[model samples]
Target chain A: MKPVEIIDIDVSYGAKKILEAITFHADAGEILGIIGPNGSGKTTLLKAMSRVVARDSGEIRLDSRNLDTLGYRELARQVAVVPQDISIGFDYTVRDIVMMGRHPYIGRLASETLRDVEICDHAMHLTNVAHLTGMSIHDISGGERQRVLIARALAQEPKILLLDEATSNLDVSHQVEILNIIRDLTGKITVVSVFHDLNLAAYYCDRLLLLKDRKVYATGTPEEVLTYENIREIFQMETLVKPHPLTGRPYILPVYTHQSGVGTNRRVHVVCGGGTGSDILQLLHAAGFTVTCGILNVLDTDYGTAMHLGLPCVAEPPFHGITPESLSGLRECLDDADAIVVTAMPIGRGNLDNLRVLLDYRTKPIILYSRNSNSPMEDYTGGEAAAVLADLETRGALRVEEAEELLARLSQGYSGRS
Target chain B: MRRTAFITIPALACTLLVSVACAAALGPTGISPGSLLSLPNAWTIIWDVRLPRVIAAALVGCALAVAGTAMQGLFRNPMADPHIIGTSSGGALGATIAIVLFAGAGRPVFAFAGAMAATFAVYFISRKRGKIPVETLLLSGIALSTLLAALLSFLMYTAGRSLHQIMFWLMGGLWNVSWDDVIVALPILVGCAGIYLFARDVNILSLSEEDATHLGVNVEGLKRILLVLSALVAGIAVAVAGSIGFIGLITPHVMRLIVGPDHRLLFPAAALAGAILLVWSDTLTRTFTNDMPVGIITACFGAPFFIYLLRSRMKT
Candidate 1:
């Protein structure tokens, strides 16, 4: 059964509608992440669930019971909320702060029971703050304070826990550590947290609810909700979404659009293979050149980089020699180019056709990047590929050893042309 | 800290006992312990005058100190006190009005009513939506207190013949208090007991109202109850002693430094410390000059200590 259900909730403050018709349910024993841009009412929605802020219209049910009808103590016993930030006025000890979470259970004229102390101790241990019990709250770092607050919430021992940007103040490693702790909390208590970092949410949350324009934009697993198109629409920003190498979950890299150079209108065709052209492609792309890379094997790392960058590419099947069809595709990419960049990839019999294709494009403005001397011994084609490269250089191709000089020479050529 | 409390409570009790004995002995006509046992006149002087005054001073001190602690916790501000929040000024104004009009019995009733009115007004004015923000509460208290002080000055200026009596009472001395004055302290004791019962809730409330509410405290209800109780205690103390200053403000803070911010220990400790402070201040006044008001002695010492605290707080 769902432990928390919010249905058709509308929240407004002084006629400002912060959230409208918000509806979702947290499944038992799952981590649900609420994600949205600033002012999308993610924190407001969490506060409404915690009853810190009242909803204008709607029903919130905890374990099929109406939230409004539950007494404050009863609600606290079932759900605990870790606020975004707290500024304590006095020097309360860490243990003092955490033990306050047991306020709902302890009665007047009664001290903390042995069981209450045990729960508090277990919470402190879980948050890795057991040793800081005697320390003042002001003496700790921001990350440690956040853990203490989470420990305070854990001391409540509720069936559901709500966090409102609990890790926002933490550094990257602490962010991961806190999220991992919360991730472990799932299956024991349903965890619902509002996250500012999409990657951390994607990594930790079992399901995500995306808020946009004060409403539920989408809700699903990370793979479904964190699509590039959805992010582009909701956040109004361009990003590349790919599977994380370690976790295979969706990871987002914001595409940097701050382009500056003379190549805004220029197109460059990169002739590279075996990952040699990957750096050149990125440099040229970042320099605002409309770049096309050709004759890379379909499964080559450079080919994958090009695909990830959303650049047009000419490709062949993995482990296959260059064919007439691929060479023809490279010739077409070479045809529309203002310049050509040939990276210093080792030539073998399998890619000897790439050299032949470059020879055909000798009349185009070509820049060759070779960090080593153009020696025949570097060729596996019995000097045939080197001879072709020499012929292409004699045909007025510029030779450069670095991508920076390549970009400089291209900008110079483009300026001269203009 | 527990060891400190264990040592401090009994130590303060012993100090209070010695101070009360010394205060009961050092009146205008000094009563030696031997003479008090032998002479009937010395016994009459001790019983009829000094004994009631000392008991009244202790009760009034305990009431004001406990009220101050509660006010500080309720407002979540260390600087909060009964005097600064206009409760004392309101009581003083009520007593001055009674002296100018009905003279004798109207003072306590009017003073209590006025103090309750001022406290509720501050509470109501500071409230926004459903919660009382600390900044607004403090600002409203200062504003209302200033206004009440102005009204009090106007009353003092208008009093033609009873002005001397009004001034002496406003200066705050326990010299004229009788056993009937001590009888008025019973309700203040009950109010303080009510405040102590909700001490845990007050601790949670001091953190933040939102936190207290989430932790199952009916924050609004608790605030209302504590505010009324604090006002009742402050009003009774002011009615009986005529606006004794600084015992409410300094005692709780000094006790907090000794025992920490936990109100369970701070409350009782502050009560004992306050009783000791006022009993000694009254004793010092009596020993120095028979006519000197106890409020003058307290303010002379308290004002400097208050400045020192403010300066030290600024350094931090």
Candidate 2:
């Protein structure tokens, strides 16, 4: 049996519904993450699984047993939850708090035995709160208090552990520390956690249950569930989704673009390559420019950014020279353009026609863009590309550093014509 | 809990024992230690008057203090007490009903029934989806207490000859405590013992109801059981001692400061300390204040202590 199997559960508070038709299951030794925006019922879903908030019409099963049939202590032996944070009302020592997790095991008449003490000690050691056993809970730091709470959950020795944004309040390093501790327990204990940080969830969770507006929007691997379109649609914002360099998991970088709306139907054809053109492409796109980019290899990062933004672009396959067909596509983009902009990407023989083609557009306003002046342009074409660049510059190809200055000059050109 | 609990529980027990002996010896009748052996009918005075009063005061104090600690821990608010939540008022109304209608027959039974009914009323009124928030709990208690007080005022207005007795009982004291009244208070130990069984559950519960449930505590059930037990204990204390006020409020706060907030240690420590506190308050009133109501003395100190708690709670 799966560790937790929730089928078509609907939860509501009075007249307000929280979750509807939620169906999912967590397997044995799997770490599942529930991720969503604020008020998306991420925490409410966790509460439903733990039986805190009663479900309206659904069944929750643990280890093949119906959840309704199990007693409170019996269910606690199988599932433990670590809250986001708790404000302890009393001055209890750390040991006293941890030992309370053993409440389900000890009978009403029996106090904790030596074995219970050993289990608590081992739990504290696992979460690194053993040294704070004698300290009052109020005296500990916020991060340390989170670890102690995790230790208390561990002391329950539950088969399934649930967390509700348990590390959301901690700093980056502390978040990493607590997530690493939780990740180490996977494959021995089944873990289901709600995460506010997408990157951490991508790295830590084996599977993700993406929620949107109290519904299961998607559920799959992080790579599948945390897609560009999915995140953009669910969160109503643009984000760049790429594989993490170290862990090979999906890493989401939010695209913070403000709609400048100043392009004003003036088409600007950009000749750029490598990853150098990705930022300007987004900035120019967000500024409402009718932008066209050209002649980049299919494998180029700039091509990916251009495609993500739905900008029309001329492209070639990887490891191939720019063909006559692509040259015509580039010529058409230049012919229809009000101005031409080129980022300071490296020049090579494979794509040297881009610079040579730029020399032909002398009548059009050609602005050579460089985000930083120190790294102008690298020529791997034996000074031939530099010669072409000098000829273009002599013919009034204005060079501008910084994307803001380039935007100002381009918008000024648009206004100057009117 | 184990470190100081070993010395603290025993030390408190011994202190209660010593305080009871001292309270019995010093009263308004003047039974000094030196003249006790030579005085005529000294044994009769101790047997018929002093011993029962002192023992009843100690038991009632233990009952009130233990109830207060449980209520504070259950509600997760240190300011919660039996008096603050209308348990004593319910019992006072019950006792007043007995005096006015039945000439004080079956007063303890009436007191207990009224206390339970009032507790359940406040509990149901404050509860929302099986959880009682601190704000609503306190507000409902105040609401019910005001209603009960209005009912009580109307009863006293029509009481006629019983108004004097009702007012005296309303301002709780230990003036006419006897061995029969002591029998009525003896079941308080049974009630306190019942509360002690859930000490560990109360510890987890004090953290937060959700956290307690994650650790396998039956939160709703635990609350119901603890509330019933507290009402029972506080109800009986009212029946015997006539609604003693802040022995419940002040004792738990002081014992929590001394023994920490672990309910296992806190329950016993506060019980002994409460018994000691009320015994002394009663003795001082009888010996020096010309037999004034002990509730007046307790309220005099307890009200200021409550204000200090409120001020410090705001600062924190």
Candidate 3:
């Protein structure tokens, strides 16, 4: 049997619905993360599994035993919850709080046994809170308190552990530290947690269950569930998803849609190479411009970005000269453009045609763009690329530094053309 | 010693024993150890008057303290106490009705019923979806207590000759306590031990009701049991000695500071200390103040201490 499973559950508070038709299962000893935007019933779903909230209609089974059939203490022996940072009103010692976790096993009218003490000590040691056991819980830091709560849960020796955004209140480093401790406990304890930070969920969870507006939008491996299209559809935001270079896990970066109106429906074909065009490409795209780029090597960083943004671009094979086919593609992009923006990129023999071609578009408005005043694009073509650029400048091409200046000039609609 | 359970429980137990003996000997009549051998009526005075009153006072104090500790833990609010939450008013109202209608027969039964009703009313009113905010509970307690007090006053006004009896019960004292009343108050021990069984559960509950439930505590079951036990004991205390205020509220809070919030240690410590406190309060009032109601003494200290708690809590 699976460790836990919820079958077609519906939950509501009074007449208002919180979760509907929710169904999922966790493997024996893997981290299953529940992720969604706020109000997506992520926490409510966890509550149902823990039996904290009554399901309107559904069946939750733990180890094939119906959840409702288990007694409270029996269920507690199987599942433990580490909640978000909570305020502890009384000043209990760290050991005292952890010892309460053994409550389910200890019968009423009986005190904790020596075996219980040993278990509590072991739990504190595992959570790295053994040294702080004698300290009052109120005197400890927030991170320390969270670890104590985890230690308390561990003291239960549970088969399943649940966390409700257990580290959302901590700083990034603390969150990572707590999650690292949790990650180490996975094989021994089947873990399920609600996560507010998607990247953290992606990095840590073995499988992710994505929720959108009270329904399971997707559930699978992180790569399968956290796709660019799925995110846009659910959260209405654009993102760039790539495999992490080291871990090979899918990492996501957001692509903005700021809609500045400076370049709405206006095409600006960037003449850039060697990653110089990356920032300009995103900026133009975000500010409502029809951004395009051209006549570059396929292996270039800018080309990868254009592919991610789905921008139209013309490219030649890596380390090859621009061929007639790619040159015609760049010419067509230029002819259809409202203006052209060129960054100070390294020019070389392989793609010198990029600048030479810009010389042909005399009447099209061109802005020689640089991110900073200090570094112009490096001259690798022995002054030949410089000569081409000077000739273009004489024909009414303007040189502007800074993205703000670029946006300002573009918003003017380039009346200087022709 | 550091107020650990190992040292504090025995030490407080010893103190309570010595306090009870000393209080029983040193009444207004001045029956010293030597006088006890000489005076003819000293045995009668000690056995019939002082001993029962002292035992009843100690039991009543213990009952209030245990009930207070349970309320604070169950609500996860340090300020929750039986008297503050209107349980005492309910008991007093019931006792007054007993005096008016049944000529004071079956007073404890009436008081228990009234206290139980008020406890549930306040609990259900303040609670929302298993969580109770501190302000809502306190405010509702105040509202219900005021309403109960108004009813109690109307009963007293219509009571005519029984008005003096109602007034004496409201002020709360151990003036006429006897062996029969001692037998009546003995069940406070059972109620306290029942609460003690859930000490570990209350410790978990002090975090949150949901947290307690997650840990395998049947939270709703524990809540009902605690409410019934608190009402039984507080109602018993009110029947025995009228509505003694603040012994419950002050004792647990003070003991928690010394012995920590672990209900295991807190229960015993508060029980002993509360007994000791009310024993002394009763001793002083009868010895020096000519038997002013013991409730006056506790409230004088308890209300100011409660204000100080509020002030310090606000500063934090």
Best by lDDT: 3
lDDT of 3 by residue, B86-194 (tens): 8988988888788789998998989888888999999999997777887898899999988998888888887665655556666689898999999999889999999
Candidate number with greatest TM-score: 2
Which should have the higher lDDT, number 1 or number 2?
2
Candidate 2, residue B81: the lDDT equals 82
Better of 1 and 2 by DockQ: 2
Model 1 ranges with Cα > 4 A deviation: A273-283, A316-326, A344-355, A370-387, A401-403, A414-418, B97-109, B120-140, B159-161, B168-170
Pairs that collide, model 3: A344-A377
Expressed as tens digits, the lDDT of each residue in B1-316 for candidate 2 is 6576779889999999999888888876778877789998887788899899999999999999999999888878777788878888898788779877999899888888788788878778877775667678878888888888778768877877565556555668998889999999999999999999999999999888888888888998999899889989899899898777778889989888788888888999999999999999999999999888898998999999988988888897
For candidate 2 chain A, which ten residues in a row score worst on lDDT? A409-418
lDDT of 3 by residue, A1-418 (tens): 9999999999998899999999999999999999988899999999999999999898999999999999999999999999887788888889988998999999998888999999999999888999997898889999999999999999999999999999998999989999999999999999999998888999999999999888999999999998888887888887878787888888888876687776777788898888999889988888878988988789988898888788999998887888999999999999999899999898888888988988788788999998876988788889999999899888888999878988888878874456
The window of 10 residues in a row where model 1 chain B has the poorest summed lDDT is B161-170
Candidate 3 off by > 4 Å:
A316-321, A373-375, A378-384, A415-418, B1-3
Report the lDDT tens digits of candidate 1 across residue range A1-418.
5799999999998889999999999999999999999999999999899898889999999899999998888888888988777888777789988998998999887888999999999999999999999898899998899899999999998999999998898789999898888988889999999999999999999999999989999999999999988998999876778899999999998876546766888899987777777777777888889999878888777897798667999888877887888888888888988898888887788877877877776457877786555541257888888898888877777678866677788987632221
TM-score of chain A of each: 0.90, 0.98, 0.94
What CA RMSD would you report for each candidate?
3.2, 1.8, 2.0
The superposed Cα distance between candidate 3 and the true structure at residue A370, in angstroms, equals 2.5
